[model samples]
Target: MLKFKTMLILLVTMSIYSGNAVASPTSQVVKDRSYYEERGDIVWEVPTQKKTIAFTFDDGPDRKQTPKILEVLDQYQAKATFFVVGERVERFPEIVKLVLSKGHEVGNHSFYHPSFQNISKEKAVNEIGKTQQAILKATGHTAVLFRPPGGSYDQNIINVSKQNNLQLILWSWHQDTKDWRAPGVQRIANKVLKNVRNGDIILMHDYVYNSSQTSEALKIILPELKKQGYSFVTVSQLLSQKDNPNTHIKVTQ
Candidate 1:
């Protein structure tokens, strides 16, 4: 009788240990999901093996430069996203229309292009709200993406974005072309091509001081990347690719 009781106790202990070991993977998965939800408001890039990327241009609808950029994209049959300022969109409504007419996506870049880091919540809302209205007024298309001017944001910006149902879009740090600096055409191309990878979101500007170089850089970048088996897509399209289990959807904080 004593021996049987001891054996029964040992078996119960082993069963408990085995159960815990089996549950460990599930517990770890829950932890990972929690961590992802905590920071899901901002997306710098997506995770995928397919050679796809997004080229996002900011401060756009420039009368001279935007048209040139559009022409190059059309030549390559590449699609991009333009984060246009509200006031700029108002001034160049026709350009905004042209951007949409060409099948490129438009996102709000704020009304006056102020950094959201130091702005009050009301001001941040105004900047974003005004841009959404302006874009709709100009192009009759509602923008669902918002890129804070200068890529600056805080909890307030994130909260406001959620309230407005806009996803906070950011670019991969490694893929910034810095074409706004008029880094020579070769340098701009190199900056993007050297470190680019699958699922990278690249940052460029349409209303830069030396805008012509951006167009020139695109002329080099679009074809070369295409040759390397990369497909240029808008931000929305990149996020919507199917069967990517590793993709994390951006959720409201």
Candidate 2:
């Protein structure tokens, strides 16, 4: 009986030590990269009750319109995401850095703004890969979000994005400002204000053929939204609020 009791105690002690050795703090638990990679593709708008929206601009690093839009956002202390064309980024690297410096998020739009649905898988991959390289080179930051040119995407785009570890971001149809059409500034602002809602992703452009109207519309949209108690955030920040309610969004600078 004595020997059996000693053996039982030793087994209990060993079990305790083994448990201690494998124990990990909740905060220290690391998820596999695939865990995040699997979440990639197709984030249109986060579903949340919070009155937060994300404004996403595409095809930019425009010397004129980008600066003007940034100024308007700065005046309202709002944050946004810029889905920049890699070729344009290379041409205007300074504007890329300026976008980042002003506390906005930058995402890869594509190298040449090609429609993904019409491209081969290899071409899609190359487009995404080259833009990823360009963004890193210009900003020293790897972009994890990609918005296909013209918001057109397919399974090929999703596969390429997963292979490159990028999330495919799209905008809500209702919130598209259509400023690229150069609709009068008031009309552009009205399109957004009239259709805006919680958890919306507003789409606008900075380097459309003529985006002066976009810059003008922002002057009205930003202040009006602020007055309506809507907070503008980056795409990642808006998604984070929905995915991890406990997570606080630290505005990227």
Highest TM-score: which candidate? 1
lDDT of 2 by residue, 1-253 (tens): 9998896555333421121111111112323323322454466667777889999998898999899999989999899999999999999999999999998999999999875535777888889899999999998999989987765555666678888888888777567676776778899899889977777888899887865888788889889988999999999998877845433222111
Residue 173's C-alpha lDDT in candidate 1? 63
Flag regions of model 1 displaced more than 4 Å.
Answer: 1-38, 242-253
Instruction: Give per-model TM-scores.
Output: 0.81, 0.79
| Clashes per candidate, residues 3 or more apart or on different chains | 0, 0
- Model 1 C-alpha lDDT per residue in residues 123-152, reported as the tens digit of each score: 988999999999999988999998887666
What's model 1's lDDT at 237?
91
Give me candidate 1's TM-score against the actual structure: 0.81
Q: State each model's CA lDDT, in order.
A: 0.79, 0.77
